[model samples]
Target chain A: MTQTNQPEINVQEKRPLDTGTAESTSSEPRFSPQVDIWENDRGLTVVADMPGVNADGLSIDLNDNVLTIHGRIEAQNPGKKVLTQEFEVGDYYRQFKLSEDIDKEAIAATIKDGVLAVSLPKMAPAQPRKITVVQA
Target chain B: MAFLPFFGRNFSGSFWELEKMRSHMDHVYNALADGFNQIRRNYTGVFPLVNISEDEDNLFLTAELPGLTADRLEISIKGETLTLKGAKTQDNAGDETLNYHRRERQAGSFSRSLTLPVKVKSEDVGAVFKNGILTVTLPKATEARAHQITVQAQ
Candidate 1:
């Protein structure tokens, strides 16, 4: 296995979605969930953090080589008076453009514990071949 | 390179330049915001961002902790203070051959403590972790709850 330096973990602040440019019709606030992506020889993997979003509330869409991930989180404990509102509960929306080497048809995804992982397999590279020289 | 994770390296040359400039601007803006937050909250950028709310019966504290199991988390409340501690480890840490393209999600131990507004029944506090969200319900103490006063007609 190739050796790689371990990344230092630090607390990352949440970024609210820019509703002005979003295509979604809902007026509810949305956030951009943090993600980790890596590529190996075989494929690329994307892991996203989307708390409070179950499998039923998540949607992954691909169009014209652009992949979009959206997760909806229903409001929790409604009608309760907020005391200390440090963070807001909202939906998650993010999109990415994939490279041409990826095989879009073979893409797979799974969601567990509000974490979504997506696998994008790379198209097999053309193998070089040697041709025998023949006198015609 | 630190901001490259925000935008992947799949854009064209000209577009990539624009993205890089945008990321630089964002970095500056974020730095300024962080400075302000340090002066105001003194506890900004804490892990597992939380929200506290209350109803008539119980006080609810919710925290977003994705990819963490119940066993990895520890929640405790003493007096009017609640403390949450947890560790998040990457499942793919053993795979060093993989080349990371974008890595914004972090893995490490985090702990946060907050003081409750009102008194709660320490023995009756209940917590549930579902869909990566941890919700702790602390029932209000009897003396802290609002009591109804009956009207007497003379």
Candidate 2:
């Protein structure tokens, strides 16, 4: 087994499956993770199920309303010699297109025990005013 | 509000039209099959996939997927719809296919599903895949998050 001297930057480019940006984006069969969303009066909260992933190997970034999450999970039996491998070992990839209503400046993320949580604050109306009407 | 579009719904206004408007949260859950032990829900324009006694508030979900990359996982949520889709490539181990005695690893494509409990922006979803495990972050709508309220006396 190999050990790292420092914490992983946890970026999308670190994945081995990132090549052929065209192949993954193409209409090819693939695997995806599960997600759960919750909304409040203030912002949005998202919970994603990512087993085998830890905090040091996770990353969260956004570009032009495109949120990207990338992480590396510890191999189940890295050093142990394997006779057979039923589970696939590769990078996880997914994409999402956001709307204009989200407050991009205040999105937060955390990974705990293989589960990732993200907080996205919603933008408020641009102007506020009180309406007054004269009684006729 | 009548003139406004239903977010995911296209001009056709058909239920299927929203398929193109999937968010990362929705994509992650939709990719999963029922597999005889799965529960999913869509509420407040969000998707939440839950099972019996699985309400740990911070439950964990790991899938058995091989021959895939981190960039392949698709997680998204549009309004209340969640979609998860990915494809496991064919195993290309050096000379392993020819000398294999028995093959039992499931291959090809995989998808998971889970409706949301609150509304979310598809662009805000986050996911990562590594060492055969894929992880994503599903953010709840600020209004749907658990919070404390104060009482005001008039």
In candidate 1, what are the lDDT values of residues A87-108, reduced to their tens digit? Answer: 8778999999998999988999
Once all C-alphas are superposed, what RMSD does model 1 give against the true structure? 11.3
- Model 1 C-alpha lDDT per residue in residues B10-87, reported as the tens digit of each score: 645567788899999999999999998776654564666788889999999988888889888888889999888878
lDDT of 2 by residue, B1-154 (tens): 4654655456546534455555654766666654322333222111112121112122223343333455665655667665656554333335322332223333344444555545544566666555345444455556654677788999
lDDT of 2 at A48: 55
Q: Chain B vs. true chain B: TM-score for each candidate?
A: 0.72, 0.50
Interface RMS for model 1: 5.8
What pairs collide in candidate 1? none
Which candidate should be chosen as best, given DockQ against the real structure? Answer: 1
Per-residue lDDT value at B99 in model 2: 32
Give me the runs in candidate 2 sitting further than 4 Å from their true place.
A1-21, A24-31, A75-77, A127-136, B1-154
Q: Looking at candidate 1, what is the lDDT of residue B81?
A: 92
Candidate 2's TM-score? 0.36
* Cα lDDT tens digits for candidate 2, A1-136: 1122322211111123444545665443233445555565676666554555667767778888888776555554333323222234443455556677889988888865455778888898789787899899
Model 2, docking class: incorrect
DockQ of each: 0.31, 0.02
